[model samples]
Target: MDAAVLITIVVMTALAFDFTNGFHDTANAMATSIATGALRPRAAVALSAVLNLLGAFLSVEVAKTISGGIVDESQISPAVIFGGLAGAILWNLLTWYVGLPSSSSHALFGGLIGAAWISFGADSVHLTKIVEKILLPALAAPLIAGLVGFIATWITYRITRGVPDRLVTKGFRFGQIASASLVSLAHGTNDAQKTMGVITLTLISAGHLSPGSGPPVWVIVSAGTAIALGTYLGGWRITHTLGKGLTKLEAPQGFAAQTSAATVILTSSHLGFALSTTHVCSGGIIGAGLGGRERDVRWSVARRMAVAWVLTVPAAAVVGAIAGKAASLGTGGVIGVAVVGIAVAVGIYLASRRTPVGPAHVVDELYTPAEPTPARKVA
Candidate 1:
């Protein structure tokens, strides 16, 4: 591929991943609100989409981390970045199809690390930076969010115990509007910038920009818009899973979870951590489950989400490694990766259409359990 053409392809792929990141993690901010009837599904996503876009301009600290902190830009090429993005996008799609809200951020990190390692060797992967930035925060943020969620939930119920049910529900539902909006805003700050960083890194590798340069204004706007559009589309499958599958949420619990997750995310962004919004929000939901009056958490669902979380990095890494190896074979190899990625993406979309989940199905699905398949219908 010509240098300009390759860079264009890489930039487009990065934006595609950003689009996936938007819908895949939409549940992190709005799931609980929808579940609690705090906001209509379509309306909630619209608000989140706008906040996500505005949040992108708050700071570029996280973008700086991504562009400079993870993989050594000097040792990698545009092909490697494309491979990494391909892997991340695939993982995001697979998780969405399964109604599992896995971490898009981790998928991105894993894809990049794996592609860089497979293409250029271990030295090209920034081990110290990975530990300091990605792994450490991944381990710590969710736990902290969960703990805060638990505390907040318990307090929410305690204070509201004497209040009338109607007042409590109405009050917290109103509060969810604010809390959920903050979570969306915080999401834009951390997640939108990942794509920005990838584009910046690609520009550096292609010699269009100097090393250590920040993302340009155009890159920021484009990335922000791609993710915002995706957010508006909504990830109803994953939203249903978080809002209704993992736990039964009341308005107060929804408020607590969103507030906790948003606080943690904004703090991380300010400090330049590429935190996973999915993990933190999921943990908050779990915590709220435990703190509820009924304490009716579905451990089975929690276990399934946990399994997905654990698998995200390795699964995405494997795909990225394969894609990276293929891309190393030159133009034909890069073209091959694109073909396979497109095929798989189309397959997943077509499959999802067969039992299409959308805003129309969200609330009804909350009250209805899946029908068990007959022997003849088992896939």
Candidate 2:
């Protein structure tokens, strides 16, 4: 394959992953709103999709972080990046199928590191930048967001304790609409930019763009549109998990969760931390559960989600390493990797048809008795 053709393939694959990121994460922002009836399903996703598209343009800090900071572009070829993206897109789709709200950001990072390490060597990877930009944020963002959500949810109920319960519910249901929309925007600002960064990094490595250059306007537009379209499609499986599985979302809890997640995500974006919206939002959901009452948290589902979180990076990394090795051989190597990626994707899609997790049955089928077991402790 021509290098230009390979670059185009990489860009398209990145966008495809972005689209999955959008729908897979729609639940991260709007699921609570929908569950609490703050907004209708269609209306909520539409609003989120639009705001997500708008949010993509708000900051290039994170994009720069990915394009130049994570790995040395000079050390890895665009083919390696493509293999990495393939790993990411696969993991995202797999998790989405199972309705686990894992971190797409981590998946991407894992894929990139895995591919780079396999193709070049450990020396090609930027460990310090990874620690500063990716690792530290992964450990901190969710905890901080959870604490904020717990406090906010507790306060939301405590202050309204005197008011009629029905009145409070009605009022906060309205408020959740705005809060969830903000979270969606924040999600766009952070999550969508990762794909833009990856695609731009691919271009830079291919020598199509100058080193240290920002993502081009077309990259932004395509990424934004891809994610928005994915959002419009919606991810019912994860939405069911967040909105109803982890805990039943009431109006007040929904409002508090969305508000806390938005604050954490927007703050991280400003600081150029490409934190996972999935992690932050999951923390908010758990916090809402805890804040609603003593021991209200569903430790079981939480455990399962936690396991998924722990495994995501390593799992994606392994797959990326395999693909990157295949891609190292040359043009034939690149085509071989692309073929396997497409084959895996098509196979997953076909298998999904038997027990489809679409918008129609997402809510009803999600949180069913058969979902994975949640973890209780780190050990």
Candidate 3:
């Protein structure tokens, strides 16, 4: 393939991945608000989409980290990046299908690491930066957000004690709207930048942009638009999982969780840490559950989610490696990877239709018991 054609393919693929990233992590911003009925699902996503576009223009620091920090862009080809994106997109879809709120950020990183490692050897992958920027932040962001969420929830409840329950609920439901909006903004600042970085890296690899250059204006705008559109579409499956599967959230807890998550995500984005918004939000939800005195945090469901989180990176990496190796073979390889990717995507989509989960069904599904008891016959 011509270099220009290859770069075009890679850029398009990056945008596709960005689109997936948006819906996959939509829960990070609006799930709590949705759960608590602070905002209607469609309205919440529309608001999130607008804020996400605005937030993308807020900072390019995380974009710089992805473009230059993760891997040596000079040593890799546009094809390798395409393979990486394919891996990330496939993983995002798979997890979305299962309604597990896995980290789209980690999947992106894992794909790039695997593709780069396979294409250019170990030297191409930056171990130090990965550990410092990606791994450490992954471990700490969630815990910190969870702790803040716990404390905030506790304080919110204590302050509202002796107040009329109806008044308390109404007050916090309003508060949740603002807090959730901030999370959507923070998400744009952080998550949208990942695709910006990927596209910039592609440009650099194709020799269109100089190394060390930040994302160009076009890259920023396209990435922002793609994510915003995806956010609008709303990954109802993951949204359902994060909002209702993790815990039953009252307005106060929802307010606390969104506030804590937005704080952590914005701070991390400013620091150029590619933190997983999913991890941070999930932690916040769990913490809020614990902090609400009457609510029970379902350990069983949490454990299932935890297992998915643990496997996400390595699983995406393995698929990326395979795809990268195949794409390295030349034009035939690229065609083959594209065919397989599309097939897998279609398969997942068709399977999801068997038990469709839409906005109309999300709250009801959450309220339904996972296992219903069989009735005994009366003699």
Give each model's clash number.
Answer: 0, 5, 0
Clashing pairs in 2: 300-374, 303-374, 303-375, 304-374, 304-375
Specify the highest-TM-score model's number.
1
TM-score of 1: 0.92
Deviating ranges (above 4 Å) for candidate 3: 60-62, 212-214, 271-274, 365-379
> Each prediction's TM-score against the native?
0.92, 0.90, 0.92
lDDT tens per residue, model 3, 4-76: 8678878988899999988888888998999998988888889999999998999876445553467786666
**Can you list the residue pairs that collide in candidate 1?**
none
Worst 10 residues of 3 by lDDT: 370-379
Question: Candidate 2 overall Cα lDDT vs. reference?
Answer: 0.81
Residue 62 of model 3 has an lDDT of 46
Candidates sorted by lDDT, best first = 1, 3, 2
Cα deviation at 107, candidate 3, in Å, is 0.6
Give lDDT tens digits, candidate 2, residues 9-56: 889888998998998899988899888888877888899999999989
Give the alpha carbon lDDT tens digit for every residue of 1-379 in model 1: 6888788889999999999999987888999999999999989999999999998888875445453457876667787888789889999999998899898988987787788889889888778886786667768877888898899999999988789999999999999889889889878977898789889988988899998888899999999999999898899889989999888898999888888888877777577664678888988888887878888888888888888888887788889889988887888988889899999999999887766777755666443435432222111
Model 1 CA deviation exceeding 4 Å by range: 60-62, 67-70, 126-132, 271-274, 365-379
Error of 2 at 24 (Å): 1.3
lDDT of 1: 0.84
